[model samples]
Target: MSVLAHLGVEITSSTDDSMDNRKRPAASPNSGSFVFWSSSFRRQPARVLIVEALPPWWSDTCTVLCDALDNFLSLACNLDGPSRIPLLSLYAVSRQQECVLPFVQVRGNLARLHSCVEELRSIPGEGCIKGAARGGELLRQAVLDSLQQFKQYIRHISTGNQTNNNLSVEITVVTSQPGPGIVRQLEMGLKDADLVSLKRLLVVQINSVGDWGQDTPSPETTYTEAEESLMLGTEVELLRMENSVFALETMLKAWLQEQGGDREHLHLLLPSPTDSPNPVCVKCDMQERLISPALIPLTPNLGVKTESVRDFLPVTKASANQNQPPQRLKVIKLLRADGLCESVLYGLPLVIRPTTCWQLDWEEMETNNNLFHALCHTLRGRDLFLLLQVEPAGGSGVYSHYVLQSSTSLSLLLKPVVSRELLLPCSMPVSPQDPVPDAMQTVQCCLTQLDEEFVFNPLSLTNNLYQHLKSRGLISQPRYPYRLQPAAVLRDQSQPPEGAKTTGSRQPRQVKPHSFLQQCEGHEVT
Candidate 1:
């Protein structure tokens, strides 16, 4: 009967003769009790325990653990599905006795853990066991014993269905003072349990006091050993943390990396400094030199604020639209005699009136337009004419002339000329009474004078003429060839003669003359 039952056979008759003669059909393996047990076992919840080997007074060890736990809880709360809640346990080891806090799924468990850690925090070093010489050994023994008991409990529960057992267990051991023996023992125990398939095993070493030496085992040793001991799918991390928020961030990033979480995209929500009732002044000599208030440091210590995970959904959505191309406006190219050009576009309200003419208010211009400022600076104290060309949709061009005026703000104040003929012959005059000589005529005269002074190379005549004209300010800076537009000529008998003046307009008014050529000549025209 026992053999038949093992083969998934059911027996109705109890007589020994009938049992010996009974025959039952073989059942499928998937329908057996073992398969059911395996499926049920795989669905079991995960268990995580944070084990602290060092005492509370060991250089902010307790505080670091509590901060880590708070980060973990924040991560849990932000989880999307049913995995948000995890079964958590805490254990604290000391020379006197080991304290085991059982796993609980209640909301108050975190509060209880915080209170327990605080109570442990209040206990001074004098209250601890006086066996300072054997403290490291005792702590190692306690950790080994606890791991052994945990393994035994798991094994005992999985006695009958050992092949189908799929429970996952994770233990995070955080310590500042780890004995060499403890690390070796952990390495050996984890190596032997490779087939048991533990979920995760992380060892965090806090170096608050900075006493690492030959006696103390380094984190690299544990990391290399743990990598070799753990199963292919299992995770093992060996982290070392200093007393800083950046160190804690590194630890959390490592933890999330093992779980296949997006480490780079996560943001930490820190408490706002504005929450304090009184304003605090943070002083720094280097920061004081910066003009922007946003660049100044608000506090020297960032660890005072608690950190939590801010979800990535809203941040992702906000950034998704951030990279849209900037809107472009229609702009006209304004070229200068110096070969420097600027793009003119309206960024503010453009008003054209008889009073203001085409005055551009510098204060109203966009502060970001650096080209405008550069053009304004270059055009200062110079007489220039702008040839305005507008191409209409009918493929016809409309042309006009505007005298470019420089103001105190160095902005362009364009005064439109009534006749396009005014643009001809480069309308800048050396003085009110004396019109500036034509650029070609001036270049010819300068070349003749240079020829008289010294026998000049015939091949260098054009170059020498440009240099001479540029020095005389007849040609502008950069010395490009200046071409004079043809003057308007009438081809009718009734039209006025070439030099005739119209009757309606008053005679050209002469203002106080300020000659740029006179100033250049005073400086020897060099």
Candidate 2:
């Protein structure tokens, strides 16, 4: 209940936001795919018009994206494609009311790209996506990839929003059009999106407020309606967003570089008439960071380094006091007194808000992950339990911290406990924080060594591995490592020194750790 109270967004949990033709569905996911299909009550060709938030540099993105997709599709057609093709944005939405879910929308410009998969090219305004500052880029590529894959089904797509940074694509379906017949041609294409909103939500009625908690498991509320629509995410993204602005400035300076002809008042995202840096994608940097671990260590780079300062202490009598056993986290078990949480029988939705934490004691310690993994491995068939620790650090509140064991069966997550609370704390933030206590007041789960080895997710066990690397002197999670490149729009003057490479300067090869041990002591990395 208090989880969002500190954030200052006063939400009426039980309040209903229902309308005449619409009844709010129960919650499923915070992030969901929408699929929409429209057969007009009055048979008529759906004329789609795009709306963009009107800004100094607004609909320009729509024009640039539409034209770019058009040109790309034109190029794709040369390779021999299907008889028909359409281009559309996979995650586009109509007026907010059209689809009643967050982060789900209609196709953007489906008219030109959906005809042939081979002919599908640019995803409109896709390069403008971002995530949380620390983990913002986490889901950007996934979203982009989904868009590209959906391009083949875009029969007609365009934008209409112009007062903000959001991009819109209004789609209409009428049988009189020349393209392929409805249904068979678009069954898979419209699985989770609407002709006007998202393809995923087309036929699926999602819960209104519950979608965020159920549909999307992503932690960051970083995706919002403001700059979120533009993707300048985090304080880290501000600089890059500004670079995009600068690139727009350069295009304004001249007018013949884009289409090889002078077209005054060009779109912001299009190549400017001026010879500024070609528009490099804001998300193009993703290729290098795949399979990258999220939890980074500070001192030297070993992540989740359980290798504490005590590891180095000798066996002398004086050292015994200094080398105490790694403290055990407090344990509180949240048992579901009522069956409200453990039941997931049908497609009917369920919301599992916490009343308290479940606890377990740490009898001993071992560095095996077989016991903790959630997906595949030894625990695939059996119901595997995992722990989620909720803490109160930023503000002093009475939300007692406890532990609850959750299991996934039949594709739905269920907890046996609903009416319990536990109070716990840690010496540090689950993320980054100022450490005041050496000992963590954790309410952790207890698993046997064999149970842990066979069940734990190897990734979770390696949590302490971050500090292991750091002690040896390795860089932590460098999502935005020092050098910042705003956009390709700037000249040598605008890029950070790291982004700049002189012709004579040989790019140094990254030194891989000879062994995890050596990297621990090789050099200092923050």
RMSD of each: 35.4, 28.4
State the weakest 10-residue window (summed lDDT) of model 2.
285-294
Best by lDDT: 1
lDDT (C-alpha, whole model) for all candidates: 0.38, 0.25
User: All candidates' TM-scores?
Assistant: 0.33, 0.17
lDDT by residue (tens digit), candidate 2, 356-425: 2223323221212223333323223443333333332223331222223333432223221111110011
Where does candidate 2 stray beyond 4 Å? 1-328, 334-391, 394-526
TM-score, predicted candidate 2 vs. hidden true structure:
0.17
Best by TM-score: 1
